[model samples]
Target: MSLLSGLPLQFSIDVSSLLNVVWLGSIFVFFIYGQRLQMYLIANDISRALNRLKIMRDKSRKEAIDYFTSSGKVTGDPTQRIDEFLDYVTIMPVDMDPRGVVEKVQHITNTRDERVRAEVSQIIPNLDPTKVSVAENILEIATSLNQIHKIVRHYYLLGKKTNSYMLLFQLQMIMPMVLQEADALVNAVDTFKLGQPVGDGIGPVIASRYMQNLPKQVVGKDTVMTVGEYKGRTLYVLKAEGPMGYVGEPGVAIQKLIEEMKVPLNAIIMVDAALKLEGEKTGEIAEGVGAAIGGIGVDKFKIEEVSSTHKIPVYAILVKQSILEAITVMRKEIAEASDKVQVLINRVIEEKTKEGDKVLLAGIGNTLGVGQ
Candidate 1:
């Protein structure tokens, strides 16, 4: 105290004692309320994220409603009906027995698709098939956003009611990823509304270009095929009948080509967009062995089944991108990678099969705004 007194007037009164008291006070306060403080901070973060998600969901829903009313013939306000439609749910087929579950799932999926299409058509009776497809996609994006917001809000309220810091913390951790997907879907709504090509369309883009000037015909439900020759190998190029927002049924098409049509194939070469890891670069290409399709496990299961049964080796060329990139507008890097994919496909065929062999070249992904 004497030394402090010599230093300055403000430091003259019991400096050491004051320091000890302040340290003890802070420790005592934190010891009693540290957990509460942490919970409060985490809850604040979750609340902010929850608000953002709500805004996105609401905005998407409004956009969908407006699109339906303006573009389609509607009597009175369609808001109520659209809201009801947004709540549509799909009940998955039970997989306990694990036999014929795939067919059941496919049936349910087909029925759901038909229902959605019919509803959209009813809402906008004036829209052509292409516009109807676009409208269906818009409604789907809104529904997805709506579901995501509800799920997050449920968890947040439940955690708050229970005063469970662990539960809140878990929600906080996943919020960023959840937001990322939500944001991507929001962008997709606009892209789809305008009928623009998406990153998911890269596969079809590659196929279309490779099969340029060749005559194409319907090979499967909403799927198409063309015959071409690549380096003395007979190429059976298959893709979704495009210039529409359709993924078509690549698995069914592949099976039909090999099984139904009895196109003797040496190997199957698939090209599709793949989701990239956090540290990975977008538009990077990788070659692998398998069906490179993404969707409900139905399509993937069918492809694997047919390929295995017929003993046809399947090769995949993947163009890696983020989930955001895959749904939103196609990036320049991804668009440029299509050229590289073609070259890789040629190499796979040359190395995997003989000169006179038939190879099924399948480009698997959505064909939105991509011409056949």
Candidate 2:
């Protein structure tokens, strides 16, 4: 035993020397290929995000196809037809001259809207108008998700192919926010499918509440108006006709009320949901001046142009919420904000317009799952 033990510790290692060698090897490897390793890591992250986006995009597309086929309205498989609609693109009007550009933009956008509506209607001819609106909304969401996925994939493949760290870095940085948006849109698909009121419906909800028991007439395309007296002032309240997903032609409605209908208005009061900052409360209320509408600037431009021509004072009451909350199902807090908005509207009207004055009240936003 003693002789065997003395034969020596052949496996013994110098701990300090071993650690130094390992540390040096690691440093050497990283020093030579650090950028490559980082690029691989970043690409891996982006690949994962890209996969998620594809899933979301495909899910919404399937939802749209299912919605149409299950309606029993179409005779054949509508997958190809629906796919064509998803890939449809609208070329924006050239803005070089910047003169009469608004009208040009408006015309182009209106045409696009009509075309989209007609295509959807043709596909599901027997579906109710309300249900058709829902299908359109779902398709719109799907289109958006598709666009996002394509864009992400394009950048990812390009970045990897070219080994562009800057490109990859930029894309990686934005992926989180992009994914959040895609997720929100995915959630909105369910909300639209169910035809439930969303946070954006807050504006129409307030208008409908005030419009109770009042006679409303069609003012514009899918838009309605009701006349009522509040605090000794004639209040003309208008909102997008609903219980379906429709923003209607709110700008057109307001313009018609003033210019075509010859309603001499002392003041214009607008209420809409506004995107809130990160720290802001969900149902926070803010009052401002201007056209309180959100869209492709067609509606806002119309309102601004007309109100300026008449020198009418425009006031805005906004209910703040996040972008996700705006499109998804209506939150309890947002629903409660409607009551507060009504009170705020009263105060604005009373303070801005004198007794015996006429004021146009435009509640602007998508009117989904909300009534006239």
lDDT of each: 0.89, 0.90
Model 2 lDDT, residue 123, Cα: 87
| Top candidate when judged by lDDT against the true structure | 2
lDDT of 1 by residue, 1-372 (tens): 787667765564678779899999999989999989999999999999999999999999999988887784766687987899888999998989999999999999999999999888777786777788888889899999999999999999999999999999999999999999999998898888888889989999998986789998897778999999988989999888878888888888888888888988889989999999889999999999998988998889999999999999999999999999999889999999998888898788888999999998888888888987
RMSD of each: 2.7, 2.6
Off by over 4 Å in 1: 1-19
